[model samples]
Target: MNGIIIGQFIPGDGFFYKVDPRSKIAGIFFLMIAVFLLKDIYQVLGALLLTFGLLIIGKISFIKVLKGLKPIFILLIFTFVFQILINRQGNILVDTNLNISLINIGLVIILFVIWRFLAKFKKFNFLLFLGFLFGSIFIFIYSSFSFDYNLTSFNLQIYEKGIEMSIFVVIRLLIIITLSTILTLTTKPTDLTQGLESLLSPLKKIGFNSEDFALIISISLRYIPTIFDEANKIMQAQASRGADFSEGKLKEKLKQVISLLIPMFIIAFMRSEELADAMESRNFVPGKARTRIHELNYSYRDVLVTAFTVVFFAVALLFRLNVLGY
Candidate 1:
C-alpha cells in the first residue's frame, strides 16, 4: 500500500510541473491511447523510450518509477506467466518432464530461504522476487536433482509465441504504469480536480454534476494513501493480537481479512462523517457555484503538448492499422 504512487504527489519544478493540469491530463489520455494502439514490438519499445524521456522531462528518476511499480510487480509476472502458459500459437520451445520429489522440494525451499534473506534490500526487491519466481519455475522445469521416490510427474511445454506475447504484455503494462506515475507525480490533487471538472463540464448539459464528480475523484485519490496507512495500522494492531495474516491457511486468512475489513469500514464511516461535519461547519454545499484562488488558463506550452500528444497518438493509430507498415 505504501508503495502505491497513483494518487500521491511529489513537489518538483519540471516541464510537466509547469504545464497546465488540463493539458497534462489530456496529454496523458492521448498517450495512453497511443500506448494501447501499439501492436509491434518496436512500436511499443519506442513508446517506452518516449515514456522514459517524459520521466526525465518531469524530473522523476527511473528508480522512483520502478518504486511505483513495486506493488504491481507480482501482477505483471503473473500476467506474463499466464500469457506464456495459455498461448499455443507457436511451436514448443521448452518441452520437459517436471517431477515433484524430495530434492526438488528442498531446493525450492532453499530458494525461498534465499529470497527471505535478501528481503532487507528493499530497492531491488522486485527483481529478487522475479528471480525467485523464475528460479523456482526453472527448478520445476528441469528437475535435475531427484530422489529414488518420485511424488508426481508432468510435462511442461513453453511455446515461442507465448514468450513473445508475454514480453509484449508486460512492456505495455510497464509503459502504462510509468505514464500514470508520471502524471500523478507531477500533478497536484487540487489541480487534477479542477482539470477533471473542466474536462467533464460538458456533461452538465446532460444533468451531470461535474463538480461533485470531480470532487469525488479528487477525494478518492487523496485518501488512497490515508486508507492504506489505516490498513497498515490495522494490520499491525491485528498482528500484535496474534493475527498472522501473512502466514496462514486460506480460512484463517479470510478470518483475518474480515477482522481487518470490519475495522476499516468503521474507520471509513467515521472519516466520512468527520469530513461531512467539517464541510458543514465551513458552510460547504454540494452543487453550488464556487470560486477558486487560481483560475485555469491554457498557455502556448499547453497547446504544444496537446499537439504533440495528438500527433503521437495519430501515428500510433496508423501503426496499429498497419498503415505505417512498421
Candidate 2:
C-alpha cells in the first residue's frame, strides 16, 4: 500500500471525478499518443504541460503523481545519465568519460529531479546517487574493454528501434499512469463499473456479457483495498501475537512470513467461496435481461474530449511521419 498504490482513490466528486471514467480512459490514450509522437524537445515539453494542466483541472495533487513515480527513481537516474553521458557529443560539460565530472549529465539529472521529484529532497538525492552509480558502472565496463572507440563492442543507431528514445517513452507512460490515477481518483467506482457495463453492451453480441464485465470491474476494484488492508492487518495481528519480523536474520524472518502465508491463503479462499455462493444465490447469470441503474449521458465535455483526442492523434501521426517536423 506504499508508493504508487497509496495514490489510490480517496473518493471525491471533484470536477474530474464527475467526468465519466470512459472519457478519462480515452483522454489518457489520446494524451499518451500526443506525447509519444514527439521527436523534438518542444513537443515533449508541451505535452508535459498539457498533462499537468489536466491533472490540476481534475484537482489531483501533483505530489500524488510524484509519489507514484518514486519507485522508479533508479530508472529515472539511469535514463538521465544515459542522456547526459552517453549522448555527450553536443556539449563538453565534463570529460568524465574517464571519471565522473559535470557535463550535460549533471544538468540532465537536474531536469529529471525538477520534473519528476519536484521539491522532494529524498527522492532527488536517491535518484542522483542512482544516476551516479549507473554512470560509474557503465564507465567501468566500457573502460575495461578499451578507451578507444575502435575497440567498442556494440552501439546501435539511435532510432533503429527507439531504444535510445526510452526517456521520452517513459515520460509518455507517466502521463498515462498519472491520468489513469486521476480518473480513478475522481470517478466513483460503482458509477465507473456501471458505465463500463453499458459501454460493453454491444459486445454482448460477440459473447461478452455486460453484467459479467461489470461484476469483474466491481470485484477487482473492491479487492485491491481489501488485499492491502488484509495484509496490513495480518502484519499487525502477527505483531500482536509476538511475531517479530523487523529483527532477526533475514532468512529467519522470511520463514516467519512463510508461516503466515497458509492462514492468509485459507482466509482468502473462504472469502472468495462465500462471494461465489452469494452471487449464485442471487440468481446472477450472464446475458440476463438486467437494466442499468444509471444511464450514461454524454455531455459536451465528452464530445470535446473525444474530438481533442482525434485531433491529437492526427497531429501525432503527422509529426511521426515528418509532416509537421518538415
Candidate 3:
C-alpha cells in the first residue's frame, strides 16, 4: 500500500502548481490518449521524453516518480515476458532447443530453494535476484547435457517484432504512470475536486449533481492515505501478537490476511459513521452550493498550456493515422 502513491499530494510551488487545476487535468487526459495513440518506438520515446520534461518542470524528483512503479513492477515484467513468448511476427532472434529432463528440473528447483533461503537472511535485491535466476535457467537450457530419449523437443524462438512491441508497451505504461504521479504530486485534493466539479458542471444541464460528485471524489482521495496508515498500524499490532505475515505457508498467510482485512473493514465502517455524524452535526447536505475559499481562475499560462496540449493531441492522431505520411 505504501508503494501506491495515487491521490497523495506533495506541496510545491512549481510550474504545475501555478497552472490551473482544470488545465492540468485536461492536459494529463489528453497526453494519456496521445500516448496510447502512438505505435512506433520513436513516438513512444518522444512521449516518454515529454513526460520526463513535465516531471522536471513540476520540480518532482525522478526517484519519487520511479517509486510509483514499484507496485506494478512485477506486472510490467510479466507483460514483457508474455509479449516476447507469444509474438511471432518478425524474424527470430533466438532459436534453440531446450533440453528438459528430470535431473535438470530437480537441479533448478534446488537452486530456487537455495535462493529463497538466502533471500531471508538479508534485504532482497530484485534485479540481481532475477538476473541470477534467469541466467541460471538460460545456462541450463543451452548446456550440452543430453538425455538418451527425447522427452519433449521444441524450439524457442524470440522475434525482433516481439522485442519492439514489448518495449513499446513498457515505455507507454511508464509514461502514463509518470504523468499521473506528476499530477497528484503537484495538485492538491481540494484543487482536484474543484477542477473536476468545474469540468463536470455542464452535466448539470442534464440533471447531474456535480457538487455531490465532487464531494465523493474528494472524500475518496482524502481517505486513501488515511486507510493505508490505518492498515500499517493494524499490521504492526498483528505482528506484535506473534503473527508472521511474511514467512508463512500459503494457507497460513491467507488466514493472517483475513485477520488483517476484517479489522480494516471494521475500522473503515467506524470511520464512515463518525464522518457522517460530524457532517450531520455541521448541517452538511449533498448537492448544496458552496463557495470555495480559493476559487479556480484560469490565467494566460493555462490557456497557452491547454493549446499546446491540443496541438500535441492533433499531431499524435495524425501520426497514428499516417495522415501526414509519418
Candidate 4:
C-alpha cells in the first residue's frame, strides 16, 4: 500500500521543486495529452525518453520511481497479458497447448506459497511477482506429465503484434505514471492548493467557488497518503487479532475485508469531522478571500518548461495528424 506515490509529496532540491506549481500543472497537463496523442512506437519511445530525462533533471532517483510503479505492477502485467491475448495480428511467436491439471494446480499452489513467503522482501517484490507469473505460465504450458487428469486444454498462440502492442501500452502507461509522479513528488500540498486557486480565480466571475474547488482537490490529494497509512495500520491490527486476509476462501476474505472497511470508514468520517471542526475553529469561511503565506512566482525556468511542453505537445499533435509521416 505504501508503494503508491500519487498524492504523496517528496521533498527535494530538484529543478521542478523550484518551478511554480501552476507551470508544473500546465506542463504535466500538456505532456499527458501529448502522451495520448502519440500514435507510433517511435513516438512512444521518444516520449518515454523525454519523461526519463525530466526525471533525471528533477533529481528523482530511479529507486523511488520504481517504488511508484510498484503499486501498478499487477495492473501493468495484466494489461500486457490482456493485450497479448487479444491481439493476434502478426507472425506467431509462441504456439503451445496449455492444460489445467493436477500438476498445474499443484504447481500454482506451490508458486503462491513461494510468493507469499518471498513477499516480505521489499526490494525483490516486483521481480518475485514477475517470476511467479511467468513460472506459472511455463508450468501450465509445458508440464506434459498431467497424470491423465487434465481438466481442460487450450492452444495458446502469441503473435509479434501482440508483443509489440503490449510493450507499447506498458511503456505508455509507465510514461504517464512517471510524469504525474514527478509533479506530485516535487510540489508541496499547500503550494499546489494555492497555485490551483490562483489559476481558478477567474472562474469566480462565473459564480464558481474556486477556493472551495481548490480546497477540495487539495484535501483529496492530501488524504491519499493518510488513508493508505490508516489502511495499513488497520490491516496490521487485524492480522495481530488472527485475521488471515491472504489465505482464505472468497467468503471469508470478503468478511475480513468488511472487518477492515468498517473501521476505515468510521475513522475516515471521524477525521473528516475533526477537520471540519478544526476549520470552523479557525474561522475558515467557504467563500472568504484568504491571504497566502507563500506566493507562487514563475521563474524563467517555468517559462522554458512551459514553452518546451508546448512544442512537445505540438509535435505530438502533428504525429497524430500524420503530418510527420510517422
Candidate 5:
C-alpha cells in the first residue's frame, strides 16, 4: 500500500524505497543476521512480529504478502510432516498418527499462515478453499483404501521438541522467503543492480567487475520470472489438449511431465535465440560503459539507514555472542 503496486514499480518517496538501494541491501543482510543469530524462541518470535510490522509499514497487505507466501506452503507442510515423525530426539507424545505432534504442528503452520495474511483475509479465502479441496481429496483416498478392505492403518510417532523446533524453523524460512520476495517486489531491477554494484564495488580492485556482473545478474533475475510465466502458459495449453498430469501413476505422470517439458525446452531455446538476436541488434556489449538514466543520489536518509543497518547487524551479532539480547 506504500502507493507502489506490488510487483510493478511506482516512483514514490516511500521511505524504504528512497533510503538508497545500498542501505536497503544492508537492511536485508542485517535482518538475516538478526533472525538467524538468535536461538531464543522469544527473539525469533519477536523478529517475525517485527517483520510483519515492517510489512505493514511498507503498505504491503498481509493478504498479498501471504499470497506470495502460499506458493511455499507445500514445502512448509512437508517439513512439518517429516519432522513430526522423523525426529527421534524428544519423547513420543502419542501413538496415533493424528496425535498431539501432528496436531500441534499442523495448527502452528495453519495459524502462522493465517496470521501472516490477516490484512486482506478475503484474498486468502482460496487457501481455506484449497484446504477443503485437499481434505476432500484425502477423504477420497482414504475411502478408496477402505473400500479395498484394508483394515490396517499406518501410525507415525513424533517427538515434542522436534515439533517445537520444526515450527520455529519453518516459520523462519517463511520470514526469509517473504522478505526476499519483498526486496525484489519493492526494489527495481535497476536499483538492485546498483545496490549489488555498490556493495561489490570494493572488490573492483580485485578484478571483480560489478557493473558487467550486475547487468548479467539483473538479466538473470529477469529471466527466471519470464521463464516461469512461459512455462505456465505452455502447461495451460497442454492441459487444454487433455494432457493429463495428475491422474496417472508416478512413472506415467513423470512421462506426461516430460512430454510437457520437451516443448518447454524447445520454446526456451527459441526464446534464447530471439534474445541473442535482440541483444545483437541493440549492439549489446559487455565490459562497456553506459550512462544510466536513473542515477543514485544518496541523501541524509540513506546515510542514516546505512549506519542503522550496520549497527543493528553488529548488535545482533553481539546478541549471538551472548553480549546482548539475554
Candidate 6:
C-alpha cells in the first residue's frame, strides 16, 4: 500500500510537467489503447521503450515506478501462469511423464517449504530467478524418480505459444501501469481536473455537467493520499494496542483488519462532512458556472506535443494492422 504511486503528485520541472494537462491526458489515453492493440512482441517492446523514454524525459525514478508495481505483482504472476496453463496451441516446450510416489511428494513439499522461506528475504529479483530455476529442476528430478508400478501417473506439457502469450500479457500490463504512474506523478490534481473539464466541455451541449464530473475526479484524486495516510495511522495505533495484522491466523487477521477499518471509515466520514460544510459556506454549488484563478492556455509546445502524440498513435495503429510491417 505504501508503494502505491497513483493519485499522488510529485512537484517537478520536467518536460511532462510543462506540457498541457489536456495533452498529457489525451496522449496517455491513446498510448494505453495502442498498448492493448499491440500484437507483435517487437511492437510491445517498442511501446515499452517509448514509455521508458517518457519516464526519462519526465525525470521519474525507475525504482519508484517498479515499486508502484509491487502491489499488483501477484496479479501479474497469476495472469502469466494462468495463460500458460490454459493455452495449448503451440509446439510443446516441455512434455514429461511423471509417477506419483511418497518420496516425490515429500520432496515436492520440502522444495515448497524452502521456497516459502527464501521468498521472505528482501532480494526480490534474485529470489524470483532462483525460484524459477529450482522449480524447473525440481520438476525434472521428480519426474525422473518414476516407479514402474505407481499409485498415479501424470503428464506435464508446456507450450511455446502459451509462453509467448503470457509474455505479451505481462508486458502489456506493465506498459499500461507505467504510463498511468507517469500521468499521476507528473500532473497535479487541480490541473487534471481542469484539463478533464476542458476536454469534456463538449458534453455540455449534450446535457452533461462537465464541471461536476471534474469536481468528482478532483475530489477522488485528492482523497487517495489522505485515505492512505489515515489507514497507516490507524494501523499503527492498532499495532500499539497489541493488535497483530502482519502475523496471525485468518480469524485474528480479520479481527485486526476490522479494528483498522472502523476507524478509517469514521475518519473518512468526518472528513467528507467537513469538506461539504466548507464548500457550502463558500457558496459552492454543483452545475454552476465558476471562474478559475488561472486559465488554461495551449502554447506552441503543447501543439507540437499533441501532434507528435497523434502521429505516434497513427503509427501504432498501422503497426497493429500490419500495414507498417512491424
Candidate lDDT values, in order: 0.87, 0.66, 0.84, 0.88, 0.70, 0.82
Per-residue error (Å), model 5, residue 81: 2.3
- Candidate 4 lDDT, tens digit per residue, 153-236? 999999999999999999999999998888878888788788878888898999988789888987887788889999999999
RMSD of each: 4.9, 7.6, 4.3, 5.3, 8.7, 4.2
Extract clashing residue pairs from model 1: none
Report the Cα lDDT for residue 116, model 4.
86
**Number of the predicted model whose lDDT against the real structure is largest:** 4
Residue 48, candidate 4: Cα error in Å is 0.7
1-326: candidate 5 lDDT, tens digit per residue: 12323354545445567667777787787778677876755666767886787777677656766667778888988887676657777677755532223334454466556655663677676676566546543443333322244434466566777787777878788778767766766788778788889799789899999988887777776677777777778778888988787797999899889988898899888988998899979988776777877777889977866675576567667878887754
1-326 per-residue lDDT for model 1 (tens digits): 66676656888888888889989988888898889888866788888888888887767889888889979988997998899889988788988888877788888999999999999998788689879988998888776653346788987789998898899999999999998888888888889889989998999999999989987887887788899999999999999999998887899999999999999999999999999899889988998898867789888889888998988999998998888993
Instruction: Give the residue spans of candidate 3 off by over 4 A.
Output: 1-6, 117-124, 146-151, 220-283
RMSD of 5: 8.7
Candidate of highest TM-score: 3
lDDT of 1: 0.87
Error of 1 at 274 (Å): 9.0
Q: Residue 311 error for model 1, in Å?
A: 1.1
Better of 4 and 6 by lDDT: 4
Candidate order (lDDT): 4, 1, 3, 6, 5, 2
Better of 4 and 5 by lDDT: 4
Candidate 5 stretches greater than 4 Å from native: 1-13, 90-92, 97-150, 217-291
Tens-digit per-residue lDDT, 1-326, candidate 3: 55565666877788888889999999989989988998788889988888788777778889888788989998999899898889999788998888766666666777777777777655566755785679666755765464534356577888999999999899999999998888888888889888988898999999998888888888887788899999899999999999998988999999999999999999999999999999989989777767767799889879977987998899899998899563
Q: TM-score of the candidate numbered 3?
A: 0.80
TM values, all candidates: 0.78, 0.68, 0.80, 0.78, 0.62, 0.78
